[model samples]
Target: MASRLAQLEGPIDTVYADIYNESGLRKETTLSKELGFKGKLIVHPAQIKIVNEVFTPSKSEVEQARKIIDAAHKAEKQGKGVVNLDGKMIDLPVIKQAEAILEYYNRLVINNQ
Candidate 1:
């Protein structure tokens, strides 16, 4: 099931696992997050905290995304189409992804507060 989910393109969201067991749910939620799931479906109220913690982007992830956007902007200002960041090439797709991550992070912050 996870392998099949991995093959799908675009933003994948809402994975489900056993809801009765908090430990098992946490593990599955973490695994789902690692596999690129944007969120999870919760059948129990107790599951919410674990799923939210697993899916929220870390501070380092947000920082790295900011750096990616900054690098892309710098490249554009220099009349270059792409830039190398941390030895990896940053292009349109990567820039868009960084933008999406920051956008998602912002939305989460706004909604949570």
Candidate 2:
């Protein structure tokens, strides 16, 4: 399903792991994150908090994203479009993904505040 979504030319921003049980949902959320899912689908209102907490990027993740974005920007300022971030070459696509993650994290923080 994730592969199919990636094959589409248009963007598929989020994927939901349709689940209900607490522990099951927690496990599913973890797998979904590994699979690049940005949200979860829940059947009950009680699942809302769990889903949100699971989907929100962790503090460490947000910090990593900030570092990636900063590195990319620094590279761009130096007339280089690609950067080696922790031994991996980061270009436009990687930078875009980092930007997206930070954007989502920022939105969540703003909404919570």
Candidate 3:
């Protein structure tokens, strides 16, 4: 199953309702996240909530992302845009990742309302 999953995973980042029902969608979302799928697809836009829930970073992740962007911004103000976070490099890319997640969540909230 792992081999087959890895094979299909890359090409099928977007899931299908035909392949999965509402309950299956929920399961697939969890499986996809475990398999490294960033998001899922839905025949109707209504499935966005499930996908959003599956893909949305956890509270801790959101906080870390926010911190990364904040620190990046501070570095930029100092004429820098890179540093080391827990021995890992923090740069514009990291900031962009954070911004992308925040934007995604914000969009979901706005559109789902």
Candidate 4:
């Protein structure tokens, strides 16, 4: 499992573990984080709150994503392929990525109902 996770993308924040085995739970959570899982895991309903608390992005993350999208759109209107944002060069692709994050975040919020 660890080996598989290593080949995946950054900031992966989820893992599934058996609820009955405390040791396994600990091992999985530890390895999940060490392997870059932020705070998501598969468990019983009793554990949903904990997993969500661990995985949800903070206010600052939402703010950053919004700013990135805004800057990217402004750059696009200016016929610029890339623009500087907080010292980083961001192009349309980067803006699209940030937009996707917001979309995904919205989906999560919507489906949670």
User: Which candidate number has the best lDDT?
Assistant: 1
Those runs of model 2 whose alpha carbons end farther than 4 Å from true positions after fitting are 1-20
Poorest 10 consecutive residues by lDDT, candidate 4: 8-17
What is the C-alpha lDDT profile of model 4 across 1-113, one tens digit per residue? 56446754446555465656655555665666556455564658755655554445556767788999999879888998899999998877788767866876676676677
lDDT (10s digit) by residue, model 1, range 62-104: 8999999999989999999999999999999899879988988
Superposed model 4: Cα runs more than 4 Å off = 1-41, 110-113
Off by over 4 Å in 1: 1-17
What are the clashing pairs of model 1?
none
What is the number of residue pairs that collide in model 2? 0
Question: How does each model score on TM-score?
Answer: 0.77, 0.75, 0.59, 0.61
Mind giving the per-residue lDDT tens digits that candidate 2 earns over 49-102? 777888788898888889899998899899998999999999888888788889
**lDDT scores in order:** 0.80, 0.76, 0.73, 0.67
At residue 68, candidate 4 shows an lDDT of 96
How high is the lDDT of residue 9 in model 4? Answer: 40
Clashes found in each candidate (C-alpha, N, C closer than 3 A): 0, 0, 1, 3
